[model samples]
Target chain A: MKIRALALALGVAASGAVSAAGEVEVLHWWTSGGEAAALNVLKDDLSSKGVSWADMPVAGGGGESAMTVLRARVTSNNAPTAAQMLGYDILDWGKQGAAADLNAVAAKEGWDAVVPAALQNFAKHDGKWISAPVNVHSTNWVWANKAIFDELGLSAPINFDELVATLEAIKKAGYTPLAHGGQAWQEATIFDSVVLATGGVGFYRKALVDLDADALGSDTMKTVFDRMAILRSYVDDNFSGRDWNLASAMVIEKKAGMQIMGDWAKGEFLNAGQKPGDDFMCFRFPGTSGAVTFNSDQFMMFKVGSDRRDAQNQLASSIMAPSFQSAFNVVKGSVPARTDVSDADFDACGKKGMRDLASANANNTLLGSLAHGHAAPASVKNAMYDVITAHFNGEYSSADAVSELVAAVDAAK
Target chain B: MSQKWWQQQLPKLVLSPSFALVLFFVYGFILYTGYLSFTDSRMFPSNELVGFANYEKLFALRHWKIAITNLGIFGGLYIGICLVLGLMLAIFLDQKIRGEGVLRPIYLYPMALSFIVTGTAWKWFLDPGIGVEQIVQSWGYTDFEFRWIKDRTMAIYCIVIAGVWQTSGFVMAMFLAGLRGIDGEIMKAARVDGASSVQLYRRIIIPMLRPIFLSAFVVLAHMAIKSYDLVIALTNGGPGRATELPATFMYSYTFTRNQMGVGATSAMVMLMTIAAIIVPYLYSELKGSKKS
Candidate 1:
């Protein structure tokens, strides 16, 4: 309690350093063309506010390498003004007092009224807002080549039966049934969709979020593994070690029938000059229509010094502004974290995402994505990643995998 | 007398900073990592002691087991194949063939490139879709299969193939240098004795090349143990950790999985392994060299 008070006092003192000279050095992993374009919107916005943007991009997908860089920089006491962090990672940094207090800006901007409570849970730590939520990314998506599906005379699968039939029919038509990269994280991405689809949202919460042993060991979980086995069979022989973008390229070239990826895959199609409904189509992975597994990309300011607080405030407000949120998420291929934002500027896919996110929010089917470091801490998530990948690679049977996951998560917790 | 004593101590004083740096960075970090293994450190280090719990977990992990097993397969094949290929290349180059200079450079060019370059080039060259299989099928043979990088059982061999392609050329140069160091008078004497070429090599040349063989073996073993990048570039330990090496495993656990303790334990085990292969060879080499 005393530590919290001291932190708040330090935070107040830091906020007083918001002066006229606004030079912000931002560290992030937004190096892809579309992501970079989206990042420019924020840069321009901050520039209008008289702040200079010093870009520090560490290029690696999934932001793992960027986190390593962040850790080293913080240890060296040269923390940047802002960094792109995922859900629990922000909380982890906040716990270590690496993040600066943003409650001053957060309160003035009515963040509590605008930002979803789910995002606020990560944005704030110990009743203090430390990070700004930028955009929401949901994992349960299956992007398909519209031409292949039209030629096959099919639509998006609505359930497990339909999904199997769709994939089988696509295989019979002599196309790669699934465009997939066989990396551990990619495999786990598909696994996350399968778990959400097979077991209901409640089961996903219990098994992934709560790390319940009984839920992990259940036959429902086994069924998910069975589906994963089928999905694994759909990938081509050259899928191993292929980049996620290359897999998307196969779909783009109409060589593959479908891809089970997050909304970020939308950016790849856009980069390829493909329209959403005409060139490709997307849907909630079968049997997970009303449910959503989401992760937000948040920008967190470090405790660099009191001098950079104004630039930090400018960045925080720019990211949360409804105008900036829509413009950014449109290019970045995610929905806005603020419900107040209008989806008028979005495409068919983005509009669908917004509607589904609303319905999922109302129905309480919205859950943090387990595979993307939102639902659970890194230790538990990585443990599950190991078990999931091992099973996918035929290292363990589904039965043994279930037991292994239980033990792994327990040890990690 | 004081000036003379100061001169004697100058070298030690000049080297003290670097010596202390080595002590703190190399040996000090190793001891720190060793200490970290005994704690329950995760994502960040902590002082909370857990006694051999991390080691226990590291051994129990299925991923670590696969990584160790892969190291055994990778190390054995990488060392044995590189040595044989290197020896054959060196012998062939020593035949005084025309354009030996050009051929030597051609064979040694791969050594000039890094392991990363070798792995990537091999990754494309051996890929079924865009590489050898595609080229073969384009020649009107439809059913060509060269998808070892994609197969779970054969992925480690892809790493092996790339590693050999990168290091064997260097090894050839080592053996070639050794062969050049041999006395031509002995060859003339053996020829006068009516000794066959095969017999001469088996009796004299092979035995005389023993020290070079030991040196090559030590170097290759060390390279095999520390091989992380080649495997990463070629397979990235994918198809579900099929080509996982000890180094990759240590990295995954320490940085990605937030299991620093387990990662440290894995690092210690790797240190012990490299030591087991190197310490004896090193001791023998140094002690024997000193005696001679």
Candidate 2:
């Protein structure tokens, strides 16, 4: 009798497990404090819909490690239900036919109409919705300590010359002019803004995104390198191997005047309990106000079992919801990916980011950031990183840098 | 079956599963990587072989050239310094000093820490702002500067320093054991013959530790070739690829840069380099044991 009872109980447990709400395994690199908090909002949203979340978090700043993990997972046919991917990596994965077709949920939720064309370019692969973009992070922003600017009597610089003058003034006053990390990505991030500022949107598109030989090796490219060299002089000697957040902390503590970083740097400032307009100021990198170099974080759905399709769709739809978009990006320090989302909940910097993104989009200046893996494929981007970083470190002259850039891009291609 | 046959067969049976696993996982993956090096695999492995195209590209890359050069400097300095320092420490410890037991563990403690931990701790210690330079400056020598970790030319040496610090202790243990195993009668006879300690070590004791030296070289050479975590935790092959080694280049190319073919090529090169060192050593060791 006891044996029969035990077997009956085991049978009941098995059926209960099978009939429970399906699971959505999400792989992401958003493991930082603010990022984790933002991710929790989505996790809770999914949980409310009777789907359990299997978190596969890989903690690397650039999502490089996460991409490696995702590749291994997909190659082994154990792909996560959803993965937080960025830029060309999404399209690359989609091209492999590993990404699920999310046209059903996307069309239902009208993702085509809401997501920006720039984002949609990556979100859709071969006319099928493959990823749901979460937020748009623009790289051409300068975060400044407002107190230093106020005390130094320096207004926001309007152009490259004025920006250089401001950095000189700040240096003359004995503060490190630029709070910058010496890492390759950080240097490349600065390069993104410098290129946009030096040659405007068209040249940036030609030189970085299109990888045009003439434009890359042109005298204008040499001028960009010269400006980069000038900017390099303003950085502190101890900047080598420093993390990006530590650079942000320099600005927060008034040790440096400004930092050229993505919108994510604002998270560090905000996390330090500083208000946007009062304590710190966010402005477009000089001369890049009308243009934005952007990379988006998107949750890409992977092809999975038929029984879990409903949960996958639910996760996709939830990610694209305007409510989640606004709430998540508010904490994530990036503007919402959706075009129609209101900026009422955003802080001063968030408001500025939304305004700049919209204007850049409307003006056809919404270029993808090469530094953040939006403009080029990983091979080309990394090749570019090598030259840009080398140039920043004074390893090459301006003319040599331009030629090297051309050569590197051609070789990588 | 005979009792002897059962004993031998049982041992083989007990080891076969692990041996098979090692063969399939290690050698099999190595062969697969060698095959992948010939293909145009990017992001994912593609079966389409490109016939030495990846090798040509790998050779053409300035980054790979820099990585190879850095490896030479790091490997040479790391091995040379570690062997010297380790021998000196072992010789000192072998003098029957007070608290030898306590001192021995202290010397070997760094080996117990992972390369990652050693790299990170040394990275902080070598940084200009918060480490040796700052401490020196605070001591009224305001002009003191130790920013090699930031200097591209000097950054590779910083890696060598960290590598040496981590492995020299283990190397010391090897040398100390070798020193201890040297028959005391030989040392006494040398002392009675009016030979100084330096002469005794140079002419006799050092020559007797040839196998230990070879073993140490083999160990350090392989460690230097496979040094990824330490470099990653330290300079991250940065200040503009100055500290890049083949291992880091292999990883960034394969995983980050989407140049899996080039990464595989680099990996195969590393494998060949390690084999060049290990194979002959293994052969001689086995041959020597057989003769004995």
Candidate 3:
């Protein structure tokens, strides 16, 4: 027993010596044009810290493929040094004991003070931080052609009634009111905005965030569905199966008036050399002002060999640094997850978002992003996805959607 | 000279690795998945057994209903069209046609490409803005609308059109091989007996191609059941789940939704459906062969 103990100590000492070199493999789903550009910032920053970053970037915007790969690695006891995880994925993985406790890094960096409470909830497992947030993306923004709105003497709407009036005016002016891709996720995105616009933050919180069935079946939800039905009418006939970038292009070409999508749509605008608030305008979806429903792209460091352990910690620290957050989120077209990041390089739209995030945070109304990531468990979210997609496709009635929503939530449990 | 038991078992030992591979890869994984279906596993497989709950959720989903409906439509049209068109193409090519070798390769080349790549090419061809619709409309048909992909009811047929285009070449190759193996003297005898071309093919050639037909049917049916990548690349089970198939649903449920139990259940449904189709087909083929 004494010899075995001595051998274990020797193994630890040898690993401790090897860890100083700092090499880590990181798995992520960030291979898109803009996403790749954003990920470079993190990789570059890590390199400057003398940490080797082994990038295993899986292609897919939703990280569906990457998650599958991650699961295989985790199941095989070969999880990467770090992995890109989001929202409930953090909790889900943490619950499965697949993630290492990031409390050491969190304590060293004092992350608990600055990170948003909702984000903390997602990144924590039983009071220990498990993931490091990179950027906060609000999914309720309405992107519009500023030139078209200006030419038509239109202003951004602040409420549902005014938004409807704007849609009608845009339609009357011989433009497609809503530039939309008829994919299920795209429909779910629009439905999320409608939920925010018609039902307000409280209803969204009660129905989606809090999972209250009564609020899901409320009159406000019915109005939201009615608004979705109206919004459906604004889409062009051939909008079905169109890619999101193509929909964004309609607005870019001045062929359409607006697109209700996440802040990531800014990447498309930027890619087209269009300046925010000049070529296009980004505003909160009507009636959801001062309310931000958000999801953060975060990296969770997994437990690996000692050599990778040092590299993972270094990468985590680098990712949270102010410069890296600013540079990464700037390219990512999202606001910095850290509230203290400088906004001097940000455009007018980004500045507005930063300001909105601050206000929403102060007002205790910063809700989790429902449409994009895990605002609920997988079962409930999928059921909600099906019901919303069906409703948008004109398969389910407004009342039926409410009933289905309730049943879906009940069934999820 | 007597050999030890260990020395005598060496040849069997050499073959054990292959047997173990087949047992594990083919059988073990399938059985493991079937075991997972009985649990309430989410994100990862859990040990807690919750019988039939996942299947219940799958059945309750409207998307699954649409997916099953689409599977039926796509499978029926795709297999039916491929069989008929492939037989016709093979028969035409077999009539001592000019450049038959070149034509055979041209017809069979599509099957060589990956389905995802083929689906992308098909998507472009079927796209309303840049494809056949645009070309036809450019030809001055102002009101022409070839937007079958945009219509929920007809979208499955559009997929079927692409599927048939992809698989017909494979079926044709199979039929061509079958035709080549046919005895030339039988055709000569039929011709001498004053049998018409149509009657000779209908009466003798088709009946002689029964084994090939069964092989093609099994191949196409398996392909149809496992159809996911093409649908994902082309439509992504989109237009609000209108074009979803069971395979895509299973994939989405497994990875995107992270409901492994439900994914396994959906996979089992696909397995059972294929079993239902192929078992009857095999039974009929066996019975017919016995009677003959």
Maximum-TM-score candidate: 2
Worst ten in a row by lDDT for model 1 chain B: B232-241
CA lDDT of each prediction against the hidden true structure:
0.88, 0.92, 0.85
lDDT of 3 by residue, B1-292 (tens): 4579779998999999999999999889888888889998888888899888888888987778888888888988888899999999999999898899899989999888888988889888887988899999999997888888777677788789888888899899899999999999999999999999889999999999998998898889889989988888777776667888999888878887878888899988888888997898889889989999
Q: Model 2: which docking level applies?
A: high
Q: How close is candidate 3 to the true structure, as a TM-score?
A: 0.92
- Computed on C-alphas against the true complex, the DockQ of each candidate is 0.71, 0.83, 0.66
- Residue A223, candidate 2: C-alpha displacement in angstroms: 0.7
Top lDDT hit:
2
Which candidate leads in DockQ?
Answer: 2
Q: Of 2 and 3, which scores higher on lDDT?
A: 2
TM-score of chain A of each: 0.93, 0.96, 0.94
Worst 10 residues of 3 chain A by lDDT: A14-23
Candidate 3: tens digits of C-alpha lDDT, residues A1-413: 99999988998876633435567788998888788888888777766666667789898878878988998999999898888888888888888877777788889988987877777888888887778899999988999999879988999998888888898999999999999998777888877778877777778888887889789888888887888888888888888788798999999999999999989889899999998877999888988888888888888878777656767778888888888888888888999887877899898888888888877877888888777764777667777887887788787888898888788877765
> Against the hidden reference, what TM-scores do the models get?
0.95, 0.97, 0.92
Error of 3 at A59 (Å): 1.8
Please give, for residues A1-413, the per-residue lDDT of candidate 2 as tens digits.
99999988888876533445677899999998899999999989977777788889999888888888888888899988999998899889888999899998887778877777877888999999999899999999999999999999999999999999999999998999999999888999999998999899889989898999999999889999999999999999888778999999999999999999999999999889999989999899999888889999989999999988888888988888889999999989999998899999999889888988888777889999999999999999999999999999989999998888999999898
